[model samples]
Target: MSVRARTAIGAVIGATLLAVLPGCGGGTSTGDSGGNSHPKTLTYWASNQGASLEDDKAKLTPELQAFEKQTGITVKLEVVPWSDLLNRILGATSSGQGPDVLNIGNTWSASLQTTGALLPFDDQTFAKIGGKGRFQESALASTGASGKTPTAVPLYSLAYGLYYNKKMFADAGISKPPATWDELVQDGRRLTTGGRYGLAVEGANVSENVHHAFVFAKQHGADFFDASGNPTFTSPGAVEGVKQYVDFIARDKIAAAGNAEYDQNQSIQDFATGKAAMLLWQAAGPNLQKHGMKPDQYGVAPVPVQSGTPGPGQNIDSMVAGINMAVFKNSQNLDGALKFVQFMTSDAEQKKLNGAYGSIPPVKTAAQDPAFSNPELTVLRNTIATSAAPLPQVPKESQFEELVGGAIKDLLADAAAGRPVTTQSVQQRLAKAQQQM
Candidate 1:
C-alpha cells in the first residue's frame, strides 16, 4: 500500500451500486440463507503482497490450510495484481459476484464505502472481529470517512520511508541520511556519479505518484479538497508540491530519464540493483531482499521534509499505507466470511502474515512481536504512529488520484524529454485536472 493504491471509482461509483451498509437499512444482508449454517469453502481475492502472485499464494497456502484444519472452512485464494485489483472489485460491486472476502488498498476504503457493496464494521460488526480498539487508531482512521462507520478494518499496516543503500552512502562519505529535501538533493548529487542516480521514482505508477504528491502537498500545506469536499487541484501550494516532486527528475536531475516510463516496481529494482542510491517506497524491504539485496546493504529513514526533521505539522512525511479486509454485502456465507476475517486479524495470524510480508501488523499485540524489532519495521511503525497522514476520504479521492497522478506522469514525461516543468506548466496541468473533476 502506499494507503495505496492502484485504485479509482469514478465511472464505477453509481454503476449499479448494491445493498447499503449494516445499520444503514434498506438493502440486502450478507447471508444468502440460514445464518447458523456456514459454507464449506470461502473465496478470497488477496491483493498482490509478495514477489509474485505465485509467491503470495505459496505464503498463504500453509496459513489457509491451517485455518481449514481448525475451522473447516477452506479459502479459495486469488492474488490480484495492483493494476487489475480496482477494476476487479468494481466488477464485483456491479455484478454482485465478488469473493466472500477481499483485500483492498486502504486508500479505497471511503470511496468504496459509497457503493454499499461492503459490510460496514459497525458496533456489532466490530465486536465480531475483535474490539474496535484492537487495531491501531492510525490504521483505523483510514478505514472510511470521518464521522461514519468504517467499511473495513486494517489488516496489514505500512508507511513510506527513504530506503538508502548504506554502502553507497558510506562509500560516498555521507555520514547519515538526509533529513530535508535540500540535503537529499545534495547527497543525491554525490551519489549520482559513475552511472548511478541519487533517487528512484515510480513516475508512471498513478497510485505511487498520488501518494508522493499527497506527502509533498502536506509539506506545502495544501489540501487536495476543501472542507466542503470540492476539488482544489491547482492551488499554489498544490502546484508547488507537485513541482517539488517532479523537480527531482527535472530540475534536480537525481533520477534517470527512463524512470518516467516506469510504472511497475522498476524503480525498486533500480534501487536494489544499485542503479539508484535512494528510494521512497512503502514497506519495500522484503521485496528488495527478494531481489537479493540484503538487510545489511540498505537502511530506512523517514521520508525527507521541506527544510527540517520529519515530525508533526509541515514535517509529516508519508501516507498511511496498508491493506483492508472487506466482506461483500451479498456474500453467500456471511458467517464464514466473518470468521475468516476474524482468523486473519487474530493476533497469531497477524504476526505470522505481517512478519512474512514485511508489514507492521495493525493489531497492537501483533505489532509488538519480537519479529518486528528490526530497524526497518521500527522506522515504519514509528512513522505510521507519528508522521504519516491519510489521503482525503472524499468520494472523488480516487478520481483525484487518477487525474492529478496522470498529470504528474505526463509532466515527468515532458521533463524526461527535455521540456520545461515550471510552476506555470504544473498549474496548467492541475487546472485541466480540476476542470475534469
Candidate 2:
C-alpha cells in the first residue's frame, strides 16, 4: 500500500462516523440461529499491499480458496485500495452496510475500536479465533483502548529501520553504518558531496513527518502524550528531537534542497536511484525491486539512537507497526467472518501471507520461519522484541498527527526558505500545534 494510504487509516480517529452517518449502531448483527453450525458465504475487504490490487488478489486468492475448502465456507474478497478503504469503511459502518471482515493499519485499531463499529475480541470471542496466547504480547496490546477488550487481532507486523546504500558508504570511506545520532551526522557529512545527498527525508508528508518525530522523540525520552493522554509536543525532549530532524536540511546541509517537498515515495525513490545514501523506512524490501533497485546495493540497520546523550532515554525505536484485521459488528455472516479471521491467523496462513507480503507474522511461532531470520528481517525482529511501541493509543491520535505533523512541515518550509529555525522557534510552533489540538 502507499505510505499515505497506510497512514491515513489512523487519521479517521476523532471524527464521528455515527454522527455524520444516520442511525449507525454497530454490533447489531442478525440473530441467525444456525450461525455456527452451517456453511456460509462471507464478504471481506482487504487492503492493497503489492504493486496493485491484482497483485494483492494473486497472493490472497489461493489462501482464501484453501480456507473455503477447509471450512466449507466461501469468501467473496474485495481488494480495496488504501485511498478508498477508510472512506468506504466509514460509509459502510455508518450506513449499516459493510463487509463482514476487513484489514486496517494497526495504528488505527484503538480509535476505530472506540466507535463500537467492530466486535471486541474478548475472551469468548478470542476462543473462536485463536487463544489470546497465540499472538505477540506487544502486537496484541495495540488493538484497543486501554483496559478494554481489543476489537481486532494483529495480522502482519513491521518496524522501521535505516536503509543505507553500501556503494555510497564505500565511496564515502565509511566502513559501518551509524549506531548513534552523532555518528549519523558525521557520516552524513562525509557521504554528501557533488550532486548526491547523505539522507533522504519525507518533509512534505505530514504523516511521515510525525512518524519520524515519534521515533526521534522516543529515542530522546519523550512521548507525544503523557499519562493522561494530553498533547506534549512542546516538551523539552520532543523539541530537541524535532530540531535534530529538521537540522538534516536546515542546519547540516546534508539533505537535498528539494527534499522539503519529498514524501515517503520520493525519499524512497531518491535512495533507490542512488541519489541519496540513506533512508529511514519500514518494509522497503518489496518496493525496492519495484523501483528497479538491486538488493545487494543497499543494507539495512537499526535506526540510530541518541546513545551519546546519557539519560533515561537513549536507544528506543519505532512502534510495533503493521496491519491488523477486524470483523465488523454488523454482518449477516458473523460466524463465517469469525472463522475467516481465525483461518487468516492460523500458523500456516500467517507464514504464507507474511512471507508473500515481506512482513513479519504477528504469531510468535509463525514469525520464527527461516524467511524472517535473514539479515534484513532479523534486525527488525530484534527491534520488535526489544524496542517497538504502538503510536500513542489515544482517541485523538488523528488530531495529534495533524497538529504535530503540520508543525514540523512548517518548520521544514521555513528552513527551505533559508529562514531561521531556532529551538525557541520550534517551541513556538509546537506550542501552537498543541493549541490546535
Best by lDDT: 1
True-structure RMSD, every candidate: 3.0, 3.2
Q: Residue by residue across 1-437, what tens digits does model 1's lDDT show?
A: 43324333334433333332322211122334444234677888899888777988999999999999999887888888877787777767765666889998888888788877789899999999888989999999899988999988899999999999999999999999999999999999999989899999989887788889999998998878999889998888889999999999899999999999887789889999999999998888888998999999999998999986777777889988899998886777778888999999999999999988889999998899889989989999999999988888887676777888889999999999999999999999999989987
Which parts of model 1 are misplaced by more than 4 Å?
A: 2-38
> Which pairs of residues collide in model 2?
319-389
Per-residue lDDT tens digits of candidate 2, residues 219-331?
87898899998889989999999999999999998888688887537887889998999988877877787899987888999888777421224566666678889887766
TM-score of each: 0.94, 0.91
lDDT score, candidate 1, position 341: 92
For model 1, which pairs clash?
Answer: none
Q: What is the lDDT of residue 29 in candidate 1?
A: 29
